[model samples]
Structure formats: structure tokens, C-alpha cells
Target chain A: MELFQNLAQGFAVALTLTNLLLAVSGCFLGTVIGSLPGLGPSNGVAILIPLAFTLGLDATEALVLMTSVYYGAMYGGRISSILLNIPGDEPALMTTLDGYPMARKGRPGDALVLSGVASFFGALLATIGLMLLAPILAGIAYLFGPPEYFALYLLAFCTLGGLASKNQAKSALAAAIGLGIAMIGLDNSTGLPRFTYGEIHLFDGIDFLVAIVGLFAVSEIFIFIESHGKKSAIGVTLRKVTIPIKDIIHCLPTMLRSTLVGFVAGVLPGAGASLGSFLAYMAEKSIARDKSKFGHGNPRGVAAPEAGNNAAAGGALVPMLTLGVPGSGTTAVLLALLLTLNITPGPLLFQDRPEVVWGLIAALLIANFVLLIMNVPLVRLFVSILSVPPNILLPGIMMVSFAGIYSLSGSGFDLILMILFGLLGYLCRKVGVPTVPIILGILLGNKMEDALRDAMVISNGEISYLFSSGISIGLWVAAIVGFVLPIFLRPFLKTPPRPAD
Target chain B: MTSDRIFGLAVLAVALFYLYSATAIQLGFLSDPVGSRTFPYLIGAVAALCGIYICIKPDPDPNWPAWPIIAKLAAATAVMYVFARLLKPMGFILPAAVASALLSYLISPNVKVSIIAGICLSLGLYLIFRAALGLSLSPFGDLF
Candidate 1:
């Protein structure tokens, strides 16, 4: 009953005119962008970040808009996976196995419907998990100190670097590079400038919003140019959106199991949705009674991975909100947004900002229903958006980005710097160096430095003071595992025939 | 092997960059332990060590170096420089529209498509940034 009241309160906040408008816009745009190949959820968040920041939106409004896009994109990604045999992000990779086969078998419409239903179920379960887990974790988060936070951030970066494919060294190098970038701007303690190079613009530090635009959005344009904006398999028009009831019933158990698996993967600090989806797909294949049907046009195969990925996306949010640590690159982008809002996450957050917490929760619930209803009937709308031709779309997105940045700062220099960063972002990505750690490094570097310095000051420069509590020690261990285990685990972790894009 | 060595060499060069910055940064008086130089220097040293490891034990090859990275970087830099020159002189939207259109040429297969794409893109951006958002962009420059 109390849950009902809280949800109602959350709904009241989320259903405001401004939020509803932004949510709808975000959902529609998210679906279009996600349906396009080579653009993933992180890229979506990163590209649209400037709009969110410069729109004069409140934290909750900005978050709701972006998060809607985040989940909405997850829903839209299956379109290409089934129809084109391409997954935009790693999370959508597993959907291709059965989805594409289903498409080839002349039931592209059914496959699309199944994917939407499975994703809806998976995301719902995960959001419910988020609603339950976040408050409990927030309660525990209250006990965390500067030491604990420092350790948690360390663990997150380490774990993320660890998980990168065969390129762990470069990933580690990327983290180091990220930390350095994070160090740029002014140091908080002595009012000292760390790496600003005497530039006043950076005195307040590099804006993650600008960085996101440059990295994800700007880089995406360069990539499209490389492919000349040509899509090999144009999406097919679907006659209908609903699958037979038996299809949904057939995939029910697989969906449920994958949701659980995905949620678990998401809750962990660094495990991304791609891993969750792939793992779920593998598990479904292993457990199937009709094993021979595993790879070619199996409804269960389509359901498990698509469901798992969506669920994992929701799960990844738990740690990002309750803890300052993000579970994936996209969540890392959201983490940057949280800092801009001045709403420090961790245990005290729920107590201090119950409305933001509950409102986000409630809005997601609404967004899920919005996604399902809009997804099926409007499926062709999203595909049609893909046919808009990148020649038009790519240039247009660029213009918006530049104009938006110009409007936000009203300073030509900021705009110039934004483009510079955009180029730099393009280069780094092409080099296969991860961009999130850099953003995380820049965004969290100051906070981490502040925490470290304060902890040292409080402890009179004794490094050992960082491990004063059991929780802190455990966190440190987690960080080490995050950094080290991925290197050893890489050889053992199964590499899919083709890695998810 | 070629990409591996290149990456390894790139790593080493970056390590050197870090080291160079560490050594060059002025470490003022010792009153502040964490100075402009301390963190960079620490990072420089650690990065160099890692660079050494990478150089010695670089992984096997992935593929031909993604050559498009160079073209993309060049185009982006050109766009940035073009915008900087235009923003104050030409104003925001017109120069932006032109530059964006030029950028479209960089993306689209044909020049005709690029121009058309660029114009439409500039229009949507104008709506979102100037009108709906009520942002003040440079409106009076003569770059156009």
C-alpha cells in the first residue's frame, strides 16, 4: 500500500507537462537513432547530452529525458537485429541469432513483436528490481565515507578496463588517460589549477556535456562518412505488429530466466548489457529440450537475449544511482549528469531527495508502458526514419549540436573548444581507446581527488587511513578484482563468432 | 603485428608526453604537497612504465589500421577552424549552415546529397537551438 502511495507521488511528479513532452520526444528520437546501425545507447546519451544540459531543464527532467532515450533505444535496437542482422550495440548482439533467422524465414513481423514483448517484460522486471534494490542500497550507502567512495570509483574503472576485449592494456592505458583528463581543470583543495594550462574556460573544468557531444555525436558522424552512410539491407515494411499468443507464451520462461540473469549482470559494477544478453542466449540454448533449433529461427533464442539486455540496462542503473559507480558506458554518462545536478548520489540521496528518486522510478514505469504501446504500431515509423538518408540526418544532427552549444554558452570560444574536443573524441574512439573512462576520469577525478585529499587531511597524510573500515577494505578488494580479473578472464570468456558492434 | 607495434609505439610516445609534462610543470614551493606537478608527474611515471610493458608485450594484430580515423580527424579539425573563423565574423546560423553543409560533403557519397542534407540539418538545428530554446546565437556576422 505504501508502495502505491510512493508510486502515485512519483507519477504526479513525472506526469507534469514538461516531463511528458520531453519523455515523448526522447522516446521517439531514441527509437529512430537506436534503429540505425553503428549507433549504440551510449552514443545516444553522449550525442544528446548537450540538449539535456543546455535546455534549462531540472535534473529530474534532464534525467527523465535521457533515461527514456536510453531504454527506448534498447527497445528500438531489435528492429535492425531481426531485419538487418545487425545489432547497434553489444547488448543487441544476441537478438541477431534467432531474430535475423526469423526474418529470413518470412516472419520478420512476428520476430519484431516477440522482441518488443520480451524487452518490455525484461525491462519491467529490472525496473521493479531497481525500485526495490535502490532504496535498500541507499540505506547501506549512507554508511559509506570518502574512503569507501574512492574505493568504489577505483573498482568501477578497474573492472571496466578489465572487461575490454584482448585490448586490456590499451583499455588500462585508456583508464590512465581518462584519469589524466579528469585531472584537468582546477584542483578543489588549494584552489590550484591542475591541468587547465592557464585557460580560464577550464577553471570550472571541462563540461561532460560538451565532451559527450564531441565524443559520441561528433565521432558518429565521422564513422558514417567512413561507410558513406550506406545501409546494405533496407528495413522491410511489416504488415502487423502482434505475434500469436502462443509465441509470447512459448518465450515466457526464457524471458523470465534471462531477466534474472540480466538483472544480476546489471547490478554488478562493470558488467554491461551485452554480456548479459549473450550469456542469456547461451544459457537458453544450453537448457533447451530441442537443442537443434537453438540457432535457426528459435523464438526462445530471440526472447532470452533481447529480454536480458533490456533488463540489464535497468539493472545497471541501480549502482549508478545508489552508488556513484556506473555499470556500463551509458550509465557512466548518466553518472556525469548526476554530478552536474549537484545531487550527490550514495546512501544519503534517497533521504535527501526522495522525490527525484521516486519520480525517476515512476517515470520509468510510465516510459516502459509508453515504449511498448508506441513500439509495435509505430515500428514502421522507426524503420522509415532509418530510410531518411544519413546524408540529411548526419549533417542535421551536427548543425543542431553546434548551434545548441553556441546557444548554451553564447561564447565563441566554448563552441570552438567543443569542436576541438569533438575531433579529439573522434581520434580516441578510432584508436579503440574507450571514451567513458576519460569522461569518468574528468568528471570523477575531481571528486576522487577531493575525497582522497580530505581523507588524507583527516588522517594526517597516512595512506593507510583510506582503509579504516571493513567496507572500505572490501571496496578496495573489489577494485583490485575489477582491474586484475578481466585480464585473466579474457582468454576464457567466450568470444561470439562476431562481437556485438 | 604492424598495428600492435604501432599501438605499442603510440603508448610509448604518450608515456613520453606524460613524462615531459611531469618534468616541465613548475613545482612551486613545497607548502602544498599536491601541486600542479604532483599528479601529472605521478601519472607520467606510471604511464611510462605501462608504455614499456606494452612495447615489450604488445598483443597480436587485429586488422589494418583504421585509416578513416585520419580523414575524420582532419575533417573535424577543419570544421572547427572554419567555425572559429566564421562565428564572430559571419554570425552563428549562416556560417554554421554552410560549414555543416561542407561537413555533409565529408559524409555523403555524392556532393548533391551533401548540400541538400546540410541545409535541412541546419534548419532543424536552428529551430531547436534559437527559436524553441530561445538561445541567443551570433546573429549579425557577415561570414555568409
Candidate 2:
């Protein structure tokens, strides 16, 4: 009953003219950005952060707009996957396996419409799960002390390395580098600077927003430059638009099962959309009557991953909103947005800023419906975006990044900082070191540090205090298992087929 | 000899410097029992250990691009640096236009299209940021 009341209040806020307009535009822009190869939701959201800030939107408006974009990108990722055999982002990789094969079989329109419906189904169910789960989780979080939070953060870092990167050592190194970067500004407890080198700009610390834009958006430009705008796959033309009602009905069970798998994967600390999609596909494959047809343009293949990844995307937001911890790379970016808006996301957020939380939920609900309605007729429009040449596209993205960053801070130094981070991001990519951990480190470092300090103060510097609480002990055990299990499991886990470059 | 080894060694050097710097952070009188330096020390140690691990077990092969592609990437990076430097002195438009043109041309070596696209992007972004978004940015400056 209370949930109903809260949701009704949320709807009132979301139905406002300005919020509705922002949601629609954000969905449109996110779809266009996500259709581009390699620019996933993280970069899509990162590129648009400056615009959101420049517009001077309030907390609710900004959250609504960004989450809409996040949902839109998930929907849009399948476009390039089916049309060009290029997964638009990492999460979309599994989609390409079945999506592209289905397209090659000449029912491109049917493949696309089916995936879109699957995505809608997965995302809608997961959003409802988030609405129910988040409050209960928040209620539990009220019991957490400093030790529990520190252990939880440790769990985040430990689990993230195992899931996010191919090499654990490199991922750990990236997290360390991020923490090192985070240590640059003035210490919160002590007034002394850690690594400022006497630069005045280092007083407030390296802005994660700048780091995000530099790493995700600017480094993308460098990658594009290196490739010289060459893409080999010719897009499959959508000759006719047809609603695949029969296919939808057949895949409904697959979508339902995959959504369950994906939502669980998403709710976990570090298992994100990529894992969600991969696990969903694998789960469906194991249970199929004929495994031979699984990868050979089966409609279930398209439906499974589409449902799984979208559900995982919604699931990732659960930890981010309730516990102030992000479950995925993109959620880490959203975490940064919430921090920048001066909103501390945790148990208190529900009590203090119910409107912001509830309104965002309502907006996401609306945005999913908007995406379903908009994607079918606009399929032709989004597919055309794939043909946009890198020359024009790269420069245009760069200009938006530059103008946007400059507008936010009006500081030339941040621009330089952005470029340096860009170089760092490029190097990390070249060396197969994931950049997401670095962003996560920067985002969570201070909070993690604060939690540790608070725990120490409470326990008079006894190291055992960190392990004293039941929650803390459980988190520590979970962290150890999460980090170690992946190593042994690596051989057994089915590697998803890589999209042809 | 591998690129991973080189990268690992670079990380090791950074960790060492960061450790040394951690030792140098001045403590305030009202510091907590844990203090600020403890976290930095812990981070430094973790970084050092990771660096050593990476150095000992390097990836077999790192796929680096050709020298020309590397050079082009460097050039684009340089343009961005210059764009940052010139943004304030010359205003957003001039620097943005020039950087956009140079980057576009580098992406696809067509001079005419690059310049037109550059000018149009700079102007168009100016309108979006300044006019539509109501953000502050100078169109032209006194530097020129």
C-alpha cells in the first residue's frame, strides 16, 4: 500500500511537462549515440554529462534524463549488432552472436522487432524488481555500521576486478592507479595535500566527471583516429517493417527465464550487463532441445541476450541507489553524477529525497514504454546512424566533449587534465587494462577511505574491528570467494563469441 | 621485452614515488588514530605488489598499432592539448574550430570537408551551448 502511494507520488512528478520532455529527448539522443559502434552507455552518458550540467538541471531532472539515456542505450545497442554484425557495446556482444546471424538469414526486420520486444520485456520486469528490492535493501542498509560499509566497499573492488577485466592483475593495478589519482587532492580529515605537487587546482581533487569524459569519451576519439574510420561490414537493409508476434510469443518463456538470470547477475556487486547477457545465452543454450540451432540464427538466441542484458542494466541500479555502491561500469558513472549533485545515495536518500528516487523510477517506467513505441517506427532512422562516417562523427563528439567540459568549469586546466586522462585511457586500452576499475576507484576511494577511518576510530585502531560485525565478516568472506572463484571458473565459463571488427 | 613489462615497470616507478610522497604528507594536530597517511600507505603497498605481479607474469603479446597510426594518435592528442591551452586565450570558437578541423582531417584526409565541418560544428555548438543551453562562452576574444 505504501509502495502504491509512493509510486503514485512518483508518477505525479514524472508526468510533469519538463520531465516528460527531457525523458523523450534523452531517449532519442541515447539511441542515436548507442547505435554507434563502441560507444556504450558509459560513454553515451559521459558525453552527455556536460550538457546536463550546463543546462543547470535540478537533481530530479538530471537523474531522470540520465537514466532515460541509460535505458535508451540498452535498447539501441541491438541495432548495430543485427544490422552490421558489430556489437554497439560490450553488453551488446552476445546479441551479435544470434542477432547478426539472424540478419544474415534475411529476416532483418523480424530479428530487430523481436529483440526490441525482448529488451522491453526484460527491462520492464527488472525495473519493477528494482522498485521492490531497493527499499528493502535500503531498510537493511540502515543497520550497517562503518565496518560493514568498508567491508562492502572491499567487496566491490574485489569482485569488480574478477568480473570486469580479462587479467586480474591489470584490473587490480587499474584500481590502484585510480586510488592513487584519488589521493591527489587535500585530505578530508587532515588539511594536508597528498599528491597535489603544489598545484592549486588539485585542492578539490581530480573531478571524476573530467576523468570519466577523458577516459570514456576522449580516449574513444583516439581509438577512432587509429582505426582511420574503417568498418568492413555492410549494413543489412530493413526492406519491410513487420511485427513478429509469433516469434514474440515463442520467445516469451526464454525472455522470462533470461530476465531472472540477468536480474540476479545485475543485483550482485560486480556482475554487470555483459555477464548478464552471456549467462542468459548460456543458460538458454544448455536447456534447448536442439543445441545445434542455438547459434545459427535461432530466434531464441536474439530474445535471450536482449532480455538478459536489459534486465541486468536495471538490476545494476539497485545497489547504486540503495547502498551507494555501483554494480556496473555505467552505474559507477551514474554514482558520480549523484555525488556531483550533492545527493548522498543510501538509506537516508529514501527518507530525505523520496521524490528524486521515486520520480526516477517513474521516469524509467515511462521511458521503457517510450522506447518500445519509438523504436519500431524509428528503426529506419537509428539504422541510418550506423552509416555516419567516423570523420564527422569523431570530431562532432570531440567538440561536444570540449565545449561541454569548458562550459561546466570554465577552467582551461580541466581541459588539460581531461587530455592527460585521455592519454592514460588510451594506454590502458592498448595494454588490455580495463578503465572502468579506475573510474570505480576514483568514485569509491574517498567513501571507502572514510568508512575505514570511521571504523578505526570506533574500535580504537584495532584491526579486528573491521571483521567484528556479522555483516562485515560476511562481506569479507564474500569478497574473498568472489575474487578467487573466477580464477578456477575461468576454464569452465563459456567465452562469448567476439564481434568481428 | 614485452610491452606489458614496460608498462608494469612504469607502474612500479609510480607506486614508489607515490609511497615516498605518502611519507611526506604533513599531519595535522587533530588527526584521527588511523590518520590520513595510513590509507595512502596501504594503497601504495597494494600498487607495488600489483606492479611486481604484473612484471613477473606479463601477457605474451601486446598488439600495438603501426608507427604511422601511433604518430597520428599522438598528433590528435597534441591538437586536444592545444585546444585546451587556446580555449581561454582565443575563446571557444577559434580553438574549437581549428581543433575540430585538424582532427576531422586526420580522421579522413579531406581538407575541404574537414574545414567546413569544423567551422559548422564550432558555430553550431556555440549556439547550442550559449543560446539554447544558456551557458556562458565567449564567441570571440581579444587575443587575436
Candidate 3:
């Protein structure tokens, strides 16, 4: 009953003219940004943080806008995947297994509609899960002390070690690099600089936005330049955009199963949409009576991954909102943005700032509906957006990124740092080191240390306090299980089951 | 594969240097029981261990970009760095225009389209950021 009251209040806030306009514009921009290959939700949200700040939006409105974009980008990624065999974002890799083949079979419109419908179902179901589960999780999180929090952070790291890259050693190396970077600047506990090397600018630590833009956006531009203006072969012509009712009914079970699988994976701190969708695709393939049709223009293949990824995106938000631990790269960016707003997200966030928390929830539900409406009838229009050449689009993005970073920091050195990080990002990508875990490490490293220190202080430096509590011990056990479980499953989830490109 | 192994060695060197720096961090008497340097020490150790592992057995060599592509990437990066230096001195529009023009030209050698895009992006972004959003980006430095 109280949840109903809070949600009603949230609706009142989200329905206002300013918030509604923000959501609509964010959705539109997110779709366009997400439709572009090489720029995923993390970059989209990261680049837009400065725009939100420049616009002078209060924290709540800014969050609403960014979260809307986050959802929009996830929804928009499917358009390119289905029409052109290229996955717009990493998680969309599974969609191309059947989506491209279906498009090649001259039912481009149908493939898109099915994916769109699946995305809509996944997003809606996941949002519903977030709404229901976040409160309960938040309540449980209230009991978490420093040891529990430290254990949770450890679990996150262990999970990332398992999921961030194909090679655990490489992923561990990336994470260590991130932690080392985070160790720069003044250490608050001791009032001493660690890696400043006598530079005055290093007193305040590296800006998260600068690191993010450089890694995700600027390095992407480098890759685009390397392509020398190569365009995807999007030759599919769309006549109509409707799925038969029977097809929708047939895929309903696949959608439901994927939503559950995605939601579960997403709620965990390391299993993101890519894993969720990959698992869902594998599950669907194994269970299907005709396994041969799994990747050869099967509509269920399109539906399962689409639904799973979108649902997982929603699921990823639960830990971020309730426990202040982001489950995925994009959510990590969102958590950083929230921190910038002086809003520490945790169990206390619900008690203290129900408006911001519940309002974001309400906005997400509405935004998913908006994406469904926009994507179903206007997907062809969205696809044509691809014709905007990278030459034009890429420069415009660079300008936006430059202007945003400059305006936010008013520091030229941050710009210099951004480019340097961009080069590092390019090098990392070239070396096949996944950068997401590095970013996650940077985001969580300080907090993890603080939690550990706090626990030690509370326990009077007792080493055994980390596992003294049941919750902490359970988290440790879970972390061990998560790290070991993926190795056994590697045979099935081997490198996304991809064929030669 | 050899390049990857060398890269792993480079990582190991960085880790060693980081560990050295971590040792130099001055600690206060009343600092947290775990202390600040312990975390960095742990990070350095993890990095060193991983670095050694990768050096011993690295992934297959990823396809490095050709010389021409590398040249183009370098030019693009140089343009962005120069744009940053020029942004505050010359303001948003002029540097943005020139940088966008340079970038677009790099992508496509067509001068006319590049120039038009440069103009549109500079003025248009100026309007969006300055006029619409009220961000304090000067149109012509602090001359106004």
C-alpha cells in the first residue's frame, strides 16, 4: 500500500511538463546515439552528463534524462543489428545470429518488429522487477555493515574477473590497472599524494567523465578513422512493420523465459546484458525441438536475446540503485553521475530521497513505453538515420564531447587527460583487453578500500572480521561460486558462438 | 603474439614502478587501521602477477592497424589535442570549426562538405551550448 502511494507520488512528479519533455528528448537522442555503431549506452550517458549539467538540470531531472537515454540506447541498438549484420552495442551480438539471417530472407520488417516487440517486453518486465525487488533489496541492504559491503565489493570484483573478458588474467590485469589509476591524487586518510609526481593538478584525482569519454567515445572515433569511412551494407528494404499475432503468441514463452533469466543475471553485480542475452540464446537453442533452426533465421533466436538483454539492462539497475554498486559498465557511469549529484545511492537513498529514486523508476517505465511506440511504427525512419555518414556524425560527436568536458571542468588539462586516456583506451582495445572491468575497478576501488578500512577500524584491525558475519560469509561463498561456475559453462558460452565475420 | 608478450612486460614494469611509489606514500599515525598504501600495494601485486602470467603466455597477436591508418589516427588525435589547447584561447566556435573541418576532411577529403559541416557544427553547437543551455563558453574568448 505504501509502495502504491509512493509510486502515485512519483507519477505526479514525472508527469509534469518539464520532466516529460526531458524524457521525450532524452529518448530521441538516446535512440540516435545508440543506433550509431561503436557508441554504446555508456558513451551515450557519459557524453550527455555534461550536457545535463550545462542545462542546469537539478539532480533528479538530470538522472531522469540520463536514465531515459540509457534505456533508449539499449532499445536503439537492435535497429542496426537486425538491418545490418553488425551489432550496434556489444550485447546486441546475440541478436545478429538470427536477425541478420532473417533480414537476408527478405523479411527485414518482420525481424525488426519481432526484436522491437521483444525489447519492449524485456524492458517492461525488467522495470517491473526493479520496482518490486529494489524495495526489498534496499530494506535488506540496510542491515549491511562495512564487512558486508566489503564482501559485496569483493564479490563484484570476483564476478568481473569471471565475466569482463575471455581471459581471467587479462581481466585481472585491467582491473589492477584501474585500481592503480584510482590510487592517484591525494589520499584523504593520510593527506599525501600517491602518484601526483609533484603536479598541482593531481591533487584532486582524475575526473571520471574525462576517463569515460576518452575510453568509450574518443577511442571509438579513432576506430572510425581507421575504418576510412567504411559503411555497413544495409540493403534490406522494409515494406511493412508488423508481426503476426500468431508469431507474437509463439514467442511469448521465449520472451518470458528470457526476461526471467535476464532479470536474474542483471540483479547480480557482474552478469550484464551480454551474458544474460548469451545465456538466454543458449537456453533457447538447447530447449528448441529443431535445434538446427536456432541461428538460421529463427524468430525465437531474435526474441530471446533481445528480451534477455533489455531485461538484463533493467536488472542491472537494482544493485546500482539499492546497494550503490553498478552491475554493468553503463550502470557504473550512472552511479558515478549520481555520486556527482551528491546523491549517495544505497538503502538510505530510499528513506531520504524517495522522490529521486521513485521518480527515476516511474520515468523508466514511461520511457520503455515511449521506446516501444517510437520503435514499432518509426523503425524505418530510425534505420534511415544510418545514412548520416560517419564523417559528419563523428565530428559532431567530438565537438559535443569536447564542449561538454570543457564546460563541466573549465580545465584544459582535463581535455589533455581525456585524449591521453583515449589513446590508452585505443591501445587497450587493440590488445584485446576489455576496458569495462577497468572502468568498473576505478568506480568501485576507492569505495571497496574505504569499506575494508572501516571494517578494520570497527574490528580493531582483526583480520577475521570480514568473514565473522553470516552475510559477509555468504557473500564470500557466493563470490567463490560465481567465479567457479563460469569456467564450467565456458564450453557452452564460448566466445559468443560466433562464426567468421 | 610477441607484441602481446612485450606489452605484458611493459605492464609488469608499470606495476613495479607503481609498487615503488606505493612504498613512498607517507602515512599519518592516526590513519585507518588498514592504511592507504595497503590497497595500492595489493593492486600493484595483482598487476605484477597478472603481468607475469600474460608475459609467460599471451593471446595471439591482434591485427595491428597499417601505417596509413596509424598515421590518420595520429593526425586525428593531434587535431583533438590542438583543439583543446585552442578552445580556451580562441573560444568554442573557431577552434571547434577548424577541428571539425580537419576531422571531417580526414574522414572524407571533400573540402566543401567539410567546410559546411565545420561551420554548421561550430555555430550550431555554440547556439545549443551557449544560447540555449547558458553554459559559459565564450564565443570569442573573454574579449566580450
Instruction: Tell me the TM-score of model 1.
Output: 0.92
Ordered list by TM-score, greatest first: 2, 3, 1
User: Cα lDDT for residue A469, model 1?
Assistant: 96
Give the TM-score of chain B in candidate 3: 0.94
Question: Residue A109 of candidate 1: its Cα lDDT?
Answer: 81
Task: Please give the range of 10 consecutive residues that has the lowest summed lDDT in model 1 chain B.
Answer: B26-35
Q: Give lDDT: candidate 3, residue A11.
A: 90
- Show pairs that collide, candidate 2: none
DockQ of 2: 0.81
Candidate 1 local lDDT, residue A227: 55
Error of 3 at A75 (Å): 0.7
How big is the positional error of residue A156 in model 2, measured in Å on the Cα after superposition?
A: 0.9
Q: What's the DockQ of model 1?
A: 0.46
Q: Which candidate's DockQ is highest? A: 2
Q: What's model 2's overall lDDT?
A: 0.89
Docking class of 2: high
- Residue-wise C-alpha lDDT for candidate 1, range A282-367, written one tens digit per residue: 88888888888866888998899989999999999999999887888888888877887787877777777778888898888888
Residue A339, model 1: Cα distance from true site in angstroms: 2.1
- Worst-scoring 10-residue span by lDDT in model 1 chain A: A492-501
TM-score of each: 0.92, 0.98, 0.97
Superposition error at A372 for model 1 (Å): 0.4
Give the alpha carbon lDDT tens digit for every residue of A307-426 in model 3: 999999999999999998888888988987998888998999999999998899899889988998888888877888866777788899899888989999889999999999889888
